[model samples]
Target: MAVVNRRGAQRIRNGHPWVFRSDLERAPAVAAGFVRVEEYTGAPLGFALWSPQSEISLRHVSADASRAPDAAWWHEQLRTAIARRAPLATESNAYRLVHGEGDGLPSLVVDRYGDALVVQLLSAGVNAWTETIVASLQELTGCTGILARNDPAARDREGLPREVRLLHGDVPRVIEVVEHGVRYLAAPWDGQKTGAFLDQRENRVLIGSLARGRALDCFAYHGSFALHLADRAEHVTAVDISAPALARVHEHAQRNGLTNIEPVEGDAFDVLRAWYREGRRFDTIVVDPPAFAKNRNAIEGALRGYKDINLQAMRLLAPGGLLFTASCSFHLSRGLFFEMLQEASADSGRRFALRAITGQPLDHPELITVPETGYLKGALLEAMG
Candidate 1:
């Protein structure tokens, strides 16, 4: 049994899944594998996947110490996760089938893009259990193929190699998914975060409903938001640094018969700044940048970047225009995100009222005890002046 210190035990009791290296009573002999977690006094706490090298030494799999994490156990856990998202399957063919800790499958994420399943084994624990995970996912979703998109940098911290491969069956070059009556082609193997940002589905629908006139979607990877906005907006400008991404956006627009969307290849920060200088304004603006703060040390710079982009976005919004802004950095709390927004609103001299605050869609559930699950923070605001 892996003995956890008092702090770790207390945290587990409170429903937190992570046990840091410092919180362990002593390092286990086995560096990377599953173990029965116990308190220093020898009381069985739970079953956890242990990774000695990583800061997150233990990821609790089950609070029931007696429960063995076998193939059947994994199947049941995965089945429950799938059942939870069953309702969402009706709305969109694309949705997150398993959201790591959110789905009680810590350190592993499996997103379903139609017949293909994109899996990310982000921890040594999950990496060790890849066969079981793949088998269970295949059984549960009956996906035509499982693509291991296990190349996220997070795996480096866990001493796992970054790799992308076909684990089972076959995957197409492009897969089509429909959300809110909009069709999009996603490249699960090539595109970002399992082809598309499934977490933003609800937010996109919400923003699409509020969209009007001209819309600008900055950091518009594959133009998911811009495509939705184009439904109501007179025109939509989708900007990104990658030309291929812009090209994909153009293709998607063409696929949807959406002629109003203009895909611009450029850095979002520069594009927003230049657009503001050009005195170009929009009725709707979305700023969904990649994680500016990779860690807590980068928080200051991230806040500055967030403020800069948001301030420019506010400046570019026409009177009564809607603004949907977001930060994906887990280190940046919801409070800090809002704080930056307040500063941006002040600097832009735009009086705005908060229309709604949003997070990842229902498929990506947030654990009340694990605050990090609430990583994506977004706000919808209406410029009053």
Candidate 2:
């Protein structure tokens, strides 16, 4: 059993599962499988899924140094993860099953949409056990189809090739899914985040319930909130930069026999500014933009962008209008996001009542120890006269 030299031992002891290359004394020739982690003094620490090509050299799978990363261990872990998500299946047809390390299975995320399973491998250790995980998913979920969308940029750091492949039964181009009683057709390859924004399922339901009178859904990719809002609101205008996404929204509305949605394709900021100039106002607004601040260096600029966009949107809100704003950037702290929103509200001379503050859905588990795991932050505010 090859051990994790010295520094790797301390990181493991510290509760971090990753084993970086620099922590090694000398590179050992080991196949992509379970490897022993040990101290320089030759004391065994744990067992990890080993991969030579990944920046995350190993993923700690078991604290007991003897257990191997084999089919039995993989099935056990996958079954446990599935059981945890069993409750979600009742709540929504589209939901995340395994969230990588958050589920104690590093570098692996499996989202279930109806009978199909979408798997993403984010690191070398997970890639090594891909077959095991896939087989277990099929056996446990009785899933008809399994697709791999391992295209995250982080995979490059693991020296793994990005790929989208079908691993099991045939999958349709568009699959019907229902969330909070609203139906949607999610495309596999084309849709964002493994065929639809399952992360926004609960948020859309919230928007639908709160929507009334005139509503606007900005940066509304694929009309998640727009379609739902249109179902209950007097009218809804959905804006997005991607014409295709807007088209999909329209198609979805048509499929559901809904006609209260208006799809607009343009830059969200420009459209919001134009609406403000036209003196057009809405009773409720949903501002769910893409990540503006991906890295720390861009945080200042991103904050300004978020503030500017939000300021324009807030200005167009009629008295007592509700605003649901969100930030998906892990680098953008909740404190910073709230501060930016406060600046926007103050600049617009608006007194807002905070209705709610939330993070991602239950499936997107946030570990208490790792703050980075909590990326999605949101606030529901109402502009009071």
Candidate 3:
């Protein structure tokens, strides 16, 4: 059994899943995988995924102190995770089936695109149970295919090799999915974050509901937001830095039969600044940039980056227009995001009425105790002046 110090014991008991290397009092005798966990004083803690080489030494797997997780245990846990998302069938065919720590299966993320599933085994300990995990998921969901996307940087920290391979049948290069009656494509093999940003599924719906007049989707990746906005707005300008991405936006717009979307290739920051200076206004604007802060060290620069785009967006908002700004950076907390928006609003010299605060939809559950599962945060504001 692995032994944890008082700090680690308290942390796990308080519902946090990770036990750092500094908190481990003793290492397990066996290899990297499932092992019994105990307090330093010989009190049983639980069963955990033990990673010998990882700085995150242990990931709490179960509260049961006696038995290690077996096939049945994996089945039960996965069964519950799949069952919880049953209601999402009505909303979208593409969504998160398992949200890592949110689903109580740390370091394991599963996203579904129609009948195919894309899985990420992020930790060495979790990857050790690859066979059983895949078997359980197949039995529980009867998915047509399973793609193992183990190419994340986290695996490198666990001393594990990163590779993308098919764990099961076949996951196509691209899969079509429907969300709130809007159809889009998911590039499961090479797309960003398991084909697309499923976390923003609801936010796209929200933006569509408020879209009108001239709409702008800054950092418009593949035109997911633009497609939705096109259904409601008269015209939409989708801006991104990549010409290839803008090309895909055109393809997506064509696929959706949306002729109102104009794909523009440019850096969102420069485009927003120019638009603001030229007195260009939009009835609806969405600033969903990629994560600026990947780690804690980048938070300072990320805040500045966020404030800049938001300030530009606020200045470009037409009177009584709606603006939806978001950040997917976990290091940028919700409170910090709000504070940044407040500061951006102040600098824009624009009076704003906060409409709503948004986050991950129903399929992607966020626990207050485990903040890692909840990274996407957004705000809906109305330009009062």
Candidate 4:
């Protein structure tokens, strides 16, 4: 059994899954795999996946110390996760089936894009058990194929190489999925974050309903938000830095017969500034930028970036217009994000009324103890001036 210090034991008992290196009494030289975690007194605490090199040395698998991390256990976990998301299947065929720690399967994420499943192994422990996980997903979803997108930056810290390839069956160039009556083509092999940003599924629908006249969607990768806004807004401009992403946005718009969405390829910040200088205005604006802060050290710079983008978005909104802004950086706390928005509003010199605060969908459940699992943060505000 791997013995943890009092601090680690107390945290585990309180529902926290991570045991950092600093919290350990004595670091064990066990191989990078599952081990039975116990208190210093030799009392069993739980079963954890141990990573000797990571700062997060221990990730609790189950409270029962005797529970084996076998195929049957993983099958049960996959089954339970699928059952939990049964309600979401009716609304959207494209949804997150497993959200790593959120689904109780640490460092493993599986996203369903219709008949195809995209899996991400973010840690060495999960990578070691990849075959079992892929098999379980195939059995549960009867998916035609499974693609391993083990290319996340987190894997680097785990001492794992970045890779993307087919694991089970054949994966076509494009996979179709429906969300809130909108049809989207997800390129799992080539696109970002397991094909698309499924975390903002519900948020897009909400902002879509509030859209009117003209809408601006910043960082509009493949036009997810812009396409949704097309249903309500007279015109929507989807802006991104990647030309390929913009091209896909155009293709997606054509697929949905959404001629109202215009794909604009450029840096979002530069475009927003130019639009403001040219006296361009919009009734609705969505500022869903990529993670400004990848780690804790970048938090200060991220806050400033968030504030700048939000301030520009606010300025672009017409009187009584709505603004939907979001930050995907887990390092940025909810309080800090809200505080940045407050500062942005103040700097914009606009009277804004908060309409709603949003986050990841029901499929991506957040454990109260694991705050990092609740990374996506969004807010809807009405510009009064």
Tens-digit per-residue lDDT, 294-380, candidate 3: 999999999999999999999999999999999999899999999999999999888999999998887789988888888889999
TM-score of each: 0.96, 0.94, 0.98, 0.96
Q: Which stretches of candidate 2 lie over 4 Å from their true place?
A: 1-7
Instruction: Please say which candidate is ahead in lDDT: 2 or 4.
Output: 4
Residue 19 displacement in candidate 3 (angstroms): 0.8
lDDT of 1 by residue, 232-335 (tens): 99999999999988888999998899999998888888888898899999999999999999999999999999999999899999999999999899999989
Q: Clashing residue pairs in candidate 2, if any? A: 4-38
**Candidate lDDT (C-alpha), each:** 0.90, 0.84, 0.91, 0.89
Off by over 4 Å in 4: 25-30
* lDDT tens digits, residue span 270-376, model 4: 89999999999999999999999999999999998999999999999999999999999999999999999999999999899999999888889988888978998
lDDT score for candidate 3 against the true structure:
0.91
By summed lDDT, which 10 consecutive residues of candidate 4 come out lowest? 24-33
Query: How big is the positional error of residue 303 in model 4, measured in Å on the Cα after superposition?
Result: 1.6
Q: What are the C-alpha RMSDs, in order, of all predicted structures?
A: 1.5, 1.8, 0.9, 1.5
Superior candidate under lDDT, 3 versus 4: 3
Where is the poorest 10-residue window by lDDT in model 1? 26-35
